[model samples]
Target: MEDKRNIQIIEWEHLDKKKFYVFGVAMTMMIRVSVYPFTLIRTRLQVQKGKSLYHGTFDAFIKILRADGVTGLYRGFLVNTFTLISGQCYVTTYELTRKFVADYSQSNTVKSLVAGGSASLVAQSITVPIDVVSQHLMMQRKGERMGRFQVRGSPEGRGVVAFGQTKDIIRQILRADGLRGFYRGYVASLLTYIPNSAVWWPFYHFYAEQISYLCPTECPHIVFQAVSGPLAAATASVLTNPMDVIRTRVQVEGKSSIILTFRQLMAEEGPWGLMKGLSARIISATPSSIVIVVGYESLKKLSLRPELVDSRHCYQRFTDCYKRLYQLQPEMTQRIYDKFITQLQTSVREEISEIKAEGNLEAVLNALDKIVEDRKDQEEPAWRPSGNPEADLRSALVPYFRQQRDALQRHVRKQEAENRRLAEAVVAGRQQVQELQRRGQARQQAWQALHREQKELVAVLGEPE
Candidate 1:
């Protein structure tokens, strides 16, 4: 349930390379195999001449089914699965190379070119034979030709194709053309894939970004990928369609050598002959590209869990990003980490109260603990404790944050001490005032007594009056 996007860093050492290679390849194979029938049908339509073998895509499908059954539609499935190795090679190379490039330069255009070129080069080397054989199977007919299939199409173009068993096809290709036969159209295949791949990636990225810009703020990311994926694929398909035709013709059994095949197509069909199946290529390739990109991204979201990335390794990447960034941009510093410390201080200060304050450090220490957790997501420390900066910052800042509680307690104690002195002063002043009042009362009484006595003396002296 952990959000994978927020997982900022993943160390190369921590990643299980083999596991992902297998998974990526296997998943890609599943999707490709599911869509193989359409591919086979498209290839069949492309290989036909003038009037063509069948009227359209559906007619071709119906004809192949009526003549060869369900298994006929999936003619080269076994050999095609061999392409899985190439798929894995492509994905793994791209991921490793792209990460390496992205770390050095922030430009996506550069990263896409480097990653795409390197990946295509490596994968094509392994998959060229598989492609040749698979195309042969896709074009391969079901029944043995007796020079009588003119009723349908060319007789020499196909023979009985033994499906299900890939080894048989391998042996057959070997008997006919030896080791070199496997790489029949290697150069053409490379020409078709390498540049197209290099261009497709950048095209996809560019279009995706453009679409995202045009879209409203609430538009989903998948929508951008969806629109960009097919458009990029269709463009690349058109540009590379000629190379694809050459690769296919050269790869087919009994076809002339690569150069001879190019000449034959040119001499027989003219300049546009190389772009024979442009429509088929676009139709098949666009959806394939879309599904692969979207599916791969979705799978990555599922697999690259924050919990699985090993937070211990993520700490180093998180730190390294800053190190690399600051080295280039000297003015920048780690403000987020500082923000984390500030938030902790504020949160802890709010908890420091007269009621919560105690002689023991329990309340203050508890507040410090809460601050560590409260600021963890903001700072994004290790998910599983990898000697992260959060722990170190906690150790360093506990005392500083504790100052809030300490200052509060000190103010409270000062107020209490002053209150004691004020009470003592008030009591002493009250006693002094009481004593003065008593003296005044005593003096008044004495005066009264004296006055009474004087009155008595006056009375005694009254005889003279």
Candidate 2:
């Protein structure tokens, strides 16, 4: 009891609500970006279910590059950024509320706890629409038959999708439900966020306090701050997993409520449906949050006086990072595409080899022709003449008849062999042409995807002005 009181007293003295919020949000963004690839894998796997979309993380990633050729993995980033901003606002509000409560109330810890809980509720309200958009965008498959065009290519912008892209999806929702369509899962989102974030932040603070008790006395408050943010994020992720699954389906499919989604999951996949992607979410969320927090905190610390760091400098740094990443993206995508194509080619070549080895009739005829040709040089004339000139002529004439018969037989066999070979060659040539056409189509699709991706990247980087 005494120790608890002492820890509370220390917490009251040491905690800075504003700094923690900024630190936490910064960390969140950093972690989110770093693990963006993993999150993408998880989303694809979830959408694919039984399909050959991807086998596992690595296999799916390889397949994405091979099938859609690289840009396919990051199709909805624009909407994602918008969604992330919504998430950040939630955290920011939570911190501000905590600070307000702490300042107004003598019991800082209790007020902070209340503030955190309420903030989650508010943030959920704001974030659900964006979440709806993001999930709808994520669940799409290559060539899944959306609207009219049947989009194909990469998440960067091709493969197989319904005609309506992200904007189209939004329009459909609006057409169906007006503004309300964007908030289809509002109730479920609130329910999930309130308990999830409320539990997460307080639990994180408690854990950090405990860790601090065990640490050396000389360390700064920043270390504890860093440790607490990740612990909070991870704890929230695991505890809220069922809700997340519910949330994802609700947002993407735009079903009724969380309960309906849950009921559907239970009916289709039993109770495990609620945990459909817990492993992936946990794997992606924890470390990703940690990285985000650590990097953000470090940057915040280094950039501590905004006046000195300057908004211009921050923008410049971000621009440089974006530029470098954008430049490398093509090379990275190409490497992945090349690797998958090589695998697919190997598969195709093996199939062709098997067909040819099955003793194709053409092959057999060609072998027979070779055998006959070898015997041609060794044989003497079929007819010969000797003694009297007239007798020799008659005898030679007899051999000529025999030779004609042999020549006729050989000619018939040769014609048959030539015909068979020609047929085989024709089939092989047709296959090659078809394969080339497919490759050409894929390349054209890839070029368009690359162009669109570049445009988006430029937009995000804000183009020097």
The candidate maximizing TM-score is 1
Expressed as tens digits, the lDDT of each residue in 339-371 for candidate 2 is: 544666799688667757895757766876887
Give the per-residue lDDT digits (tens) of candidate 1, residues 1-465. 211111232323335665556567767877776667777876665556533466666777798788877877787787789888888788778878988996687565787789888999999999988876777667667443211111122354343354433565567778878888889878888898998888898888778778877877566666777888889998888888778877776776456577887787788778877766666567667667777568666556445645565444443354454454434532222334445546766876765654366554686678768988788778554342336556654554476568778999999999999999999999999999999999999999999999999999989988774
Off by over 4 Å in 2: 1-31, 44-62, 103-112, 145-164, 216-228, 291-465
Clashing pairs in 1: none
**Model 2: ten consecutive residues of lowest lDDT:** 1-10
Supply every candidate's count of residue pairs whose N, Cα or C atoms clash at under 3 angstroms: 0, 19
Q: How close is candidate 1 to the true structure, as a TM-score?
A: 0.62
